[model samples]
Target chain A: MSGTDKILLVDDEADFVSALSERIAHRGLAVDVADNGLKALDLAGQNAYDAVILDLAMPEMDGIETLKRLLDLNPDLQVILLTGRATLQQGVEAMKLGAMDVLEKPARLDLLLDKIRKAQANRVLLVEKRNEEKIRKIVDNKAW
Target chain B: MPWSPDPRWRDSDLAFFGAVTAGATHELNNVFSIIEQTAGLLEDWCADPEADVPAGCDKILNVTERIARQVQRGTELVRRLNGFAHSADEPCCNQEMNDLLENLLALMERFAAQRRVRLVFEPAGAPVTLTTRPFILEQAVFLAVSAALAGTAAQGIVTVQLTGGGAGVEITITGAPALPEAELPAAVGAWLGPPLWNLEGRVRTAARAGKYAIVLTIPKISEEVP
Candidate 1:
């Protein structure tokens, strides 16, 4: 939390993902890119990322499946889904499946950053709330 | 509507047109998808109202405009398709060669771009109007163009010229690579005469000055009957 947040970006379009990742990194966040969902899940397991930005229409374990696997590994992980064209149904489905946010492709960099920041903040709040609850329970117990 | 009539004849033409339109639209969709992704990236950058104006904005705008042109090109294709469909309904009519070429060019532009080839249309002295089935004329022109385009390389150019002559109107397609006389596709050379009524044309490979040209000629009429 003190240093720049680490973000995992998954997209099949290399040129698009490369440009986006560079732009996001320019905004002071650490970004690691994976071209497919499987690699993204592998990276998620290997690292504790602040958030994951995923694209839905990819070959071999798409964004939705990737999201499920990432959350399964770290249930508190924050994720944002990226879709192409005007897919409203997929966006809604992504949200229902615990995605922090769903964005249309060719999305503005600022908007993506805003969502990333918000998701990271919420993750921090969730962790802090759990810590506070633990402290309260400890104080009420006689066993140290 | 008649159950007695041959069902194959009823839907065959329609089905072929549909398939051609769908293929063209699918290619157009891919182009649009690239543009959409780039535009989304630009929008992401501009969302920060207070962020310092970046130097990349100009580049993004240029790409977006290019994408817009492609989308417009796609729209023109749909229009051409509608015209082509209507032409089928009125089989025999006065067909404007220039207008038909224009429509064919619009539809084939993206296809040419995809293959990295260039298709150029050169008009003669004046518009050569002929009395014939527009759809049949269109198919002939389309086939000729498709053949010429297929032979050319990605960077090659296929020139289509509409010239006025005493015998009739000559539609010449030059710049196609010379295929060995033996390699000509059997179907293309099988002499499928005038796919439409009142239209007489031939697809033959002629060599002039050591260059091969695929020429198609359709005779023009002076007037139309009531």
Candidate 2:
């Protein structure tokens, strides 16, 4: 399952998450499932995932908290929050908390996949930019 | 001039609007998600050209067309919800009774579906137009329909009829449990009365032939009342 399309899926609803993961896996994309935010955090820490499909409402740790922790561990990680019912306030809060974007649950798989692909592309760009900065700083120090 | 604004009701109205709109968007999100997954599956199949191209491509195309159909359904739902939100923009305006029923009913469909109630609207005559507070009128209609849905038996039908009556068009919601005037909530009667009165209309809840009906009479206004 370790491939360019590797992704983490976190949701408490066993049936929904399992079904969605199966569908995503059928698309030739690698999927790792986590039933709760804490487990998602643990997985994020141990393994490398390009993007995380996270649910907002959870038992202990909510999506926002999980999002902050995942990003803290890997700043380049793309997190998309899945909401059952979206209110105007929740959208703003999600963005402020450093979420890539929020998609309502049972979101069109095509759209969700598009967002994931975009997230992967963005992570690559950020990594490349950071490397460029680091190389420039090293070259400057050597010149000095 | 007859209509007076109640600052308290505004909160309740806003809350109701938020709830209905939230429910609509939530449902739409699920709809879009399903279509997205369907399209993704097609893309996966198309990415692999090694399979039997002619036969496999034909099956993939069928799924692709299904995605297009879902897009159409999602578009209509968004358009109807947009119209519903706009009904609250103006304090008072000229509105078509059927259009109002259509818009409001579309918003309430998910809620009604949960209770297993069917909402149907019958246009009694031509398009009936009246000058009134659109949002207030919508709230009145919403309450009446909700009550009917709540009071009726499971798998019941609430029929809303739009017809010309005494001074203006009469919007009748029938097929709910009947309640006498004494049984009516004084707060409801008090709250819904002023807006209709200001619009030169009236709302009456009466029992006829064993079933209860909420009759809203709106008198046509030739000039703006402000």
Chain A only: TM-score of every candidate?
A: 0.89, 0.92
- Candidate 1 docking category? incorrect
- Model 1 chain B: weakest 10-residue lDDT segment is B1-10
Which pairs clash (backbone N, Cα, C closer than 3 Å) in model 2?
A107-B33, A108-B32, A108-B33, A108-B36, A108-B37, A109-B36, A109-B37, A110-B36, A110-B37
Report how far off residue A94 is in candidate 2 (Å).
Answer: 18
- Model 1, B90-116: lDDT tens digits are 756766778777776667665555445
TM-score of 2: 0.57
TM-score of chain B of 2: 0.78
Interface RMSD value for candidate 1, one decimal? 7.4
Each candidate's clash count: 9, 9
Q: Give each model a TM-score.
A: 0.53, 0.57
Instruction: Give the local distance difference test score of model 2.
Output: 0.73
Query: Judged by DockQ, which candidate is best?
Result: 2
lDDT of 2 by residue, A40-114 (tens): 989998887778989876655767888889989988888998877656688788888788999877777778889
